[model samples]
Target: MTNSIIKSLSLPAPEEIEVAIRGQRALATYLSTRLETQKIAIQDADNNTHQIELPTSALTLLMTILGELAAGNAVQIVPVHAELTTQEAANILNVSRPHLVKLLEDGALPFHKTGRHRRVLFADLMKFKDQRDTNSQKAMQELSDLSQEIGLY
Candidate 1:
């Protein structure tokens, strides 16, 4: 998602964020504690009402996503099977277009040729990004441990 879109999704004020956070937390707590309250009520702007039931796992995931948004974090929901252009994928990864192309060429990321252009699947991109993030975290942790052992931390 573009920064402008993300900015637009951001909470208008800190107080709104706080209120949203609390509301999500409260709903989560209530639903978890009250087993009888299986379905949630959804009200539309037109005053229409809908109710849907969710599994506990799904409810937990919803709560987490809402919590992140309520904390003023920009969240983008993309379909797993979505295909993205090279520039869009690079933007998501916060990398240069050339670097992304290099990765695709080097077999670091999988892509398919659409005519003359490369198209990357959202799922594959996410898998690669998750692996890279895990590796970076591991390296950082090792460095911190080494520093601690040497009395530098």
Candidate 2:
């Protein structure tokens, strides 16, 4: 049980670690240290271990997650018109602000400048991504059909 607990805590990704803990009663029970401001400890069914404590790092992450939840994210679940400044648009595209501006100037994304700073609508961004996906799928299908037609598959 100690070996498994150690293995799970040492997992590379926090999500995978949390999943391992939740899936294994023993793993959850092996947690040994946490700060006072950390989350309340939860016990597994048929409790056999009570001396264990959740790690402070894990608890801090959980607290941040709780904060995010409380900050209201359900409203952002659906794509809608979101007026975004240049910096925000850059973040959405995973590009530098200047590069995003260049794309905007090249008519890549439907955007407008408000007194020098540019703004984008979230709906337009979603449509752009959708079109890209559609085109990519169509191209892939064409390639697959060609390969089969040529007896390559």
Candidate 3:
């Protein structure tokens, strides 16, 4: 099944950033141990309290989100197994949609056809991106070494 569409999130306000900073600090304190699960007590605006057990992994993810919010960044979570549209994949790579399509046609990236639409697995796309980034870094390093050898760097 197709995953839900990605939604744009607005930047956090000053007050929200402050709250996120506090929340991230509070959450970080609980992550010092190697516990599989943690029991947390939460209070609502109406003064109602609830206790819930959450996986440590989930808590760490929450802490990361809070840290991003504290830094005034907007964040979105995508499942690794989700299928992404060409446009969405392009957005993630900061590339144009036509370039993404060309890459797909050239076999630089893997995709499957759903009827007539092409869908890229998020995991495959990420793997391709990581490789591309590594290649770029290697090329830059080579260029820098060449420049240094020529006494121009």
Candidate 4:
């Protein structure tokens, strides 16, 4: 996606932001206490209205994304099968190109070559990121436990 589109998605209109923040909490409550089936209504400028049913899982994701945008955090939605260039993959991972290359070589992340350039599947990148995050959380928890046992925390 272009930077402009990303920037726009990262922010909501002033009124929209307020609504989104409220919606985030409201959606969570509904998901927790009410039914999982939900429908959303859209109204066009001409006053034509349409309604669509959304799975609870999808609604949860939408609520979370909206909340993030309301808080001025950037969010990007990439199709699972999308192919990304080495640099694009690096940017997504917040790492340098060379580091991403190393991960690819180490089999920590998988990639395929198109001519001289390497391309990573969006799904594979996300898998690697999820595992890395889980590992980091585990390590932090271990450290915290050790510190507490040693009377350092």
Q: TM-score per candidate, in order?
A: 0.73, 0.44, 0.93, 0.72
> Judged by lDDT relative to the true structure, which candidate is superior, 2 or 4?
4
For the record, the alpha-carbon RMSD of candidate 4 to the native fold, in angstroms, is 3.8
For model 4, residues 1-153, the per-residue Cα lDDT tens digits are 222212344355688778877888877765642557788777999999999888877887888787787796667777788888878888878999999999999988888887887888889988999999999999999999999999998
> Higher-lDDT candidate among 1 and 4?
1
How far residue 47's Cα lies from its native spot in candidate 2, in Å, is 26
Q: Model 1 off-target regions past 4 Å? A: 1-16, 33-37, 44-50, 55-58, 145-153
Candidate 1 is scored at a TM of 0.73
The alpha-carbon lDDT assigned to residue 129 of candidate 3 equals 96
Residue pairs with clashing backbones, model 3: none
When summed lDDT is taken over every stretch of 10 residues in candidate 1, the lowest stretch is 1-10
lDDT for every model? 0.80, 0.60, 0.91, 0.79
Q: Which stretches of candidate 4 lie over 4 Å from their true place?
A: 1-10, 22-39, 53-57
Q: Give the lDDT ranking, best first.
A: 3, 1, 4, 2
Position 136, candidate 3: lDDT: 100
Model 4 alpha-carbon miss at residue 69, Å: 2.2
Per-residue accuracy of model 2 over 1-153 as CA lDDT, tens digit each: 111111222213555445444544443454335444333445579774445455576655554443444443211232365577767667666779998888789998898766776778778877877887899999999999999999999
lDDT of candidate 4 at residue 34, scale 0 to 100: 58
